[model samples]
Target: MAETNKPTATKGVLSIAMIKKLIGAVVGIILGVYIAGIGVPEGLTTKAMWGMAVFICAIVWWIAEVFPDYVTALLMCSAWAVFDIVPFGTAFGGFSNATIWLLIGAFGMAAAVGKCGLLTRISLYLMNLFPLTFKGQTLALMVTGTLMTPLIPSGSAKIAVLAPFAAAVSDSMGYKKKTQGAGGIFAAMFLSLGCIHPLFLSGSFMCYSVVGLLPKDIQSQVTWTSWFINALPWGITVLVLGYLAILFLYKPEEEKRLASTMIKDQRAALGPMSKNEKYVSVVLVLTLLIWMTEVLHGINATIIAIAALAALLGYNVIDRNTFKSGIAWDAIMFIGCIFAVSGVFSALKITGWIGKVLGPHVAPLLAGNIYLFLAVLCIVIYLVRFVLASQLAVITIFTLLLTPLALKEGISPWIMGFTSFVAINVWILMYQNAQYLVAFFGAAGGEMVNHRQMIKLCVAYMIISIIGLLVSIPFWKLTGLIQ
Candidate 1:
């Protein structure tokens, strides 16, 4: 209905999207010029003030949705080098960063898995292991998504692979659009895929990006095994609590069993694994094993991932087209640009100045009490998400401001960084989570589940995420992350 009612474009009349772009453009340019005109403040360099202006403009354009995120990122990166805020190599240095390569390699592996029908086959096998009841189906989806997390690092990629299966399951069960059963299946899949990302370094590019934002010394310590160990308790708590929330909020009208024929039939339809599937499975397993054993081998994670990509290409498991289309180049550009932006921010001493200015005001609430600090931090991040469209922005800003204080209080900066990542990832609105939007509109086809029911799941996630973080304090203590 909303789509049908959208006003058509006409000469001399602008659409809402166009109006947003215009306003964003005008506001961004004006602010950038005005800020640049201001004299550099005490204790901050001239380049830092200009960097702030450019960063602010880019952020405004991003929140306004003026252009694709990658485009905005491109503009920011170009601005830094053009304005001499940083050297050209420094401004564009993220392109050569190891973290960027890791993401590129991960996306390629995901593409191979997705293209070979392995992801779909695995999903069906997982779902078919359970009963055909509504509760059983929803639980199956949650479990499948969790299990798939390690194999597929990108949440959007996972949703792309699983959401269609979820919709098919909903239809097979006689559930219609906006129906409780259908909504439950989607809620379980989307939320479960989202919440478990922090548990593994390869779980999502967001995890890798956040870790990249940390200091170099801290980055070396946060390998795959240590990340899982640190995040296991919190990740498990959120997954269980979130599943319970879905079951509670989207109860089915009846408990009758549905047909399992569709699931079993689909699994059988594949007949046998092709050579590509076998090759992809081998490469994926070997890559994961190498990643997990990084402590002993002492090889960088990026090298292993690049090697996996090479193996896939060498074996012809994925062709040149797959190499081009399979990787999320836009995400790669966006993340790389963000890294450059953050580098400039750090070099300009902007973060230290922010800490100095805001530290005193935030010190009391955050002082000496790790629990209180976390609680307050979570609440602030929750509110910030309402306006900040980019999760990376939220993570970067909060980490810069609060990490110094956290370290001063005998807390690891990883705790602060990881908590902020988790808090910002939980969303109660459609627009807040881009990955969820992709799942809803792409996999679910914007029909299998409706916004009203999904909102209930989102609210549940919001509350449960906070509870999960709070519950993990004891575990963090045991790990010696807190004094």
Candidate 2:
């Protein structure tokens, strides 16, 4: 009788999924038709109408999860080409962007690090040092994640590398899934990963991509070191606040004399480091050194990443098969497609059209009040992430729309770009991105914590982030970034 019911249940789930997809399709088509039918304003090209239609449809599909994000990205590009919104060559041009190659290399290195057992060794070693209590274990995981940020540009990759060890540590400490202890552990991991992005240019692709969107004069002034200096204080503050918030909201039951033996035993099992580990370590360190000294060396960060990948492949740390299967191709493709579409916007001047339409109406209200403008802008961007799935997409779209207005209102483009990058990352729920989802569910197949608990913790962190931005305004002004 149980066996007979299994197939029926499976069919029920499939039917629901099919219905959702169909509804999403109908909604997307209707939205496209409605927007395309609207008349274009004076000084806007006919192509802008088609571009706007495709953009709306893509957003609808993305929010509805009508298709996988990469598939939606491909469909967007196809629409651009077929409708002559841009030339065929231009629509698919993201494949040639250097950032895509950088992502490939970064992801390849992560795979190599994971395959050689180094990631496990590092995580276990950290947890072992503070294994006596839940708070200590949470701090250890947070520190490990923070340390890995500069080396791993992808937050999802960092989570993928450390999540398994986090699960192991939680289980060994007798903290079962859905308990406060488990909730605290997962919360620490999630918040740390989210907060680390602003600290360094290499921390995430979103950081440098924002820099790329800046005007040429401003872009030339920004460097890896400058970005680190500008954002370090806020990033550290968020991490500290996140740690405290977790402890306050989810107080784990006291476990006196909890054994640290599991981590030690696992560390002992690994024995000594192998040749592959040593080689990957050396390459990672050298790559980081080069990335830090870009001012003196004058090599682009993307090129440095590619060279590191080549060294990994050259030394046999990662072979073709491992490299092919290991990289996050979906993420890379989505980024590339977004970048390509951005280029099309630049070429056709659609971004300029956006500024022309919205700038006059909004710029006058905030002309003399920089602080109020910054606060309102940041909050609006933060709230907008609820409907958007991709951080990169948010940064690309809103930055294009708002940067001109920011400049016209006497605010520095640098401040506008930096604040937008940070705001888009402030998510209150797991459905916002894949990294959030991974951290919400443990590496092993079970829910790590209750949804309400996670939401409360995220809300606290967002409040802290906003306060941090408000306090930093004077410092930014003194530093000549906002005159």
Candidate 3:
């Protein structure tokens, strides 16, 4: 329940954004109606045409923010069913996906952890370990965020938890809003919190969505440990290069040491861990242990996550209100719809048609050289991020279109999928990264860091992200992801 700084439409007000959304909604409806009425195009079925119509509208609305993403998702599935583009079961199949439940379970656990302040105490304790200087605090924030990454499921949730502490530290150091010191602190926090998501399966909901989009056989092969192992090379590159990049890009106005009590006071404010904290800790740790050891136990992560959530609730670590409020139901709805949309896309043959249309031009690039293919793929997604406000949408669409070509090139589709996921996570522009924006304007508050400095960090992110994927090519080849 951390407050987000996303802009809202005021009643009876006609903001430029609202005007754009209205125009987008009307255009979306018109485009959908026109596309649907044009009859089946060559190489596409009537169902595919209908699916395209729904998709066009959904994409427009999604980019326009015409509705909550979950609401738009619901509309997509309902339209599919109403138009008979797919069966009701197929249109809504994402709800039946175990990935959806896993996300739910993860959110539940995150809620309990946040609600009980365990994450806060841990973060402050870690930050307090470093000397109070700008560089020290920056490193401390990065380490804290990275260590906490695997434990918390949501990147935004982690930002919400870390922003206040970062702000307090900045203030203590006399780094005013928009100053270099304040900007550095917040930028480091955002980078550390957001950049490493793809390194862990449960690190972001987007990771689960990526896995959900994979072929069933591949999905079966991916586990928490396996995902970590596969992404380690890229993750290490990003972590090392990204941290160095931050230090190089931003400098503090002064090198003043932090007041020792600033971080210590925050840590001490929590006093002793409460019973809820202890119980939630135990459940989360045990769940993570199970996830990491999935190869040995042969248990699915979803089951472990569900069990962990159940334990939290069963042991009263999460109260009824906490369960209802803590879990990100909107994320669940949106993620489920992503799965459903992917299913509908396949069922209607849209995915295959998309692959066919784009395949010839793209296949040549992917056919002979894995490194060349990855570079091209990363650049494409990075450019696509310019117009597409939704990172998940970009990841899903590119993965769907190029996966076939990757497979044809004797490459594992996972390389394509993971590469696209990393590429799309960048935010060179302010609007490109929603979670970063929310953290900057929401948790970190607009006063801490200005857009100029963050954009510099974002440019660094764009370069680092692409390099991370390209450098991982060797390791991926060693792992048989590339032949």
Candidate 4:
């Protein structure tokens, strides 16, 4: 490759940013034309160009790490609107979606919980329980996380809930935690993805709410009871299985934190739970109860969560700044932007088009063969984890497109829903999900294993989990064990 020192050509109007935008436009035009030639989306060159442009830019922003993911998302939305990809209102209107509000409100509740030291207190209480054996301690942690995930749907929330606590446990036990980094990572990963557990219902708030937005017939088959029943067994099974797998696979080289890293030294600092902690605990339980019985209570979990915050604020337990500090705004914007752009995908029915393409190839394999279809779909969704880095992204895109196709293929919608749920969390390779790697690496994602090793590990995980699911599925069907 050759290098140049002089400035590159600018736009005809002559400005650096204008030149980049022109380049983006030109690249979009070329790619759109090529896609039209190859048959992904047909006709309407203008719309295709704009859609592909936002898509391209979004990917580039992530690869470049030029800005936060949410920034990239908002820019994608702006690009679509500015380029007239869809009606301006259509592009921006989804920002006001009730789905988005629930996510935002959930973020607020997570923040409030954190500021009140409720998560630490809760996590410590969980960690400190059970016998001193590794088996007992691990089981306790798994139970604590399983119960917590649905209420805090964000994977990041799980990380916040578990990472520090895990680190603290490692410290308290005097275990150096080097060899068992994978175990630590695995424990945290469960917190991130285990929200679909049976505690709430047939589905997670996000999954159910997204699915609920479907037509009533589809919605009826995927109620809370049904989804929770179908999913929780596998969800709980996978988490426990994965946890035990890590424990059996590795142990710390030497105990660094065991029996030495506790607050046992500082008698004055170590005290019992205070009144504020009790108050937040009550608020959390009430919020969860209200959330689970949304239909009967006629009030959403979000309002209850917000009310809890207001109550905290009223009593000056957590002032505005503390509360504000608790919120993870990146999650809100990132999820919201992705949801809004999903409107464009909805507007263009892009997933529908992809469905048309895959339908023929997939139908024969799935026809009259629920086992083959379910197994293949799970692997495909699992392999898809390699391509998509974020669990939420995988769930959103996969469920949006695959659920409808699965239904159309004569596979039970409920079965497909369960398969999709399993796929999102079953990824075992280090790189496939950031939440898995974050604890191991000490950030969201800062490390990598070679592609070959990653693929092999993922394949092993995919094969094992699929086999387990297959053996268990018959039982699930016979006893009507799952939702």
Question: Which candidate has the highest TM-score of all?
Answer: 2
Instruction: Summarize candidate 2's per-residue lDDT along 358-459 as a digit string, tens digits.
Output: 446545655767767767767776666654445676677667666776777556677777777777765464445555544443244335566667777767
lDDT of 4 by residue, 1-483 (tens): 124423344233357555665565566456545644554445335575457556655655554444555676677778788878877766666567664455444445555555556655554555546654455566666666666665544444344335445554444444443435334434434443442342345225446545643546867666556656555555555565556564554444543322423433332254666787778677757766666556565775556655765776786777778655555555455555655655676676654454455556655665556667668877777665543434554556546555665567544555555456557664354334433432333222222122232233344445546655676576666645333
Model 3: weakest 10-residue lDDT segment is 1-10
User: For each candidate, what is the lDDT?
Assistant: 0.75, 0.72, 0.75, 0.53
TM-score of 1: 0.71
lDDT tens digits, residue span 1-483, model 1: 666555544422666668989999889988987887888877798888888888778867876778976798799889999989988887887687776777667667777777788877766676568877878888888887787787555566456546666776676677877888788888887877766778787788778888888789889888889999888888888888887888888888766574577777777888899999999999988877776555567777688778998999999888999888666666567767766755676677775565465556665676756677777878777876654545776787777677777778777889888988988875564446666655665444467887777877776777777787788889888888877
Residue 45 error, candidate 2, Å: 2.4
lDDT of 3 by residue, 56-170 (tens): 7887887777996679879988989998889999989989988667666766776677678786776566656887677888888888788878866656545644666677667
Please list the Cα RMSD from the true structure of every candidate, rounded to 1 decimal place.
6.2, 5.3, 7.4, 7.9
Off by over 4 Å in 3: 1-18, 37-41, 133-138, 144-236, 244-258, 366-373, 381-460, 469-483
Predicted structure 2: lDDT: 0.72
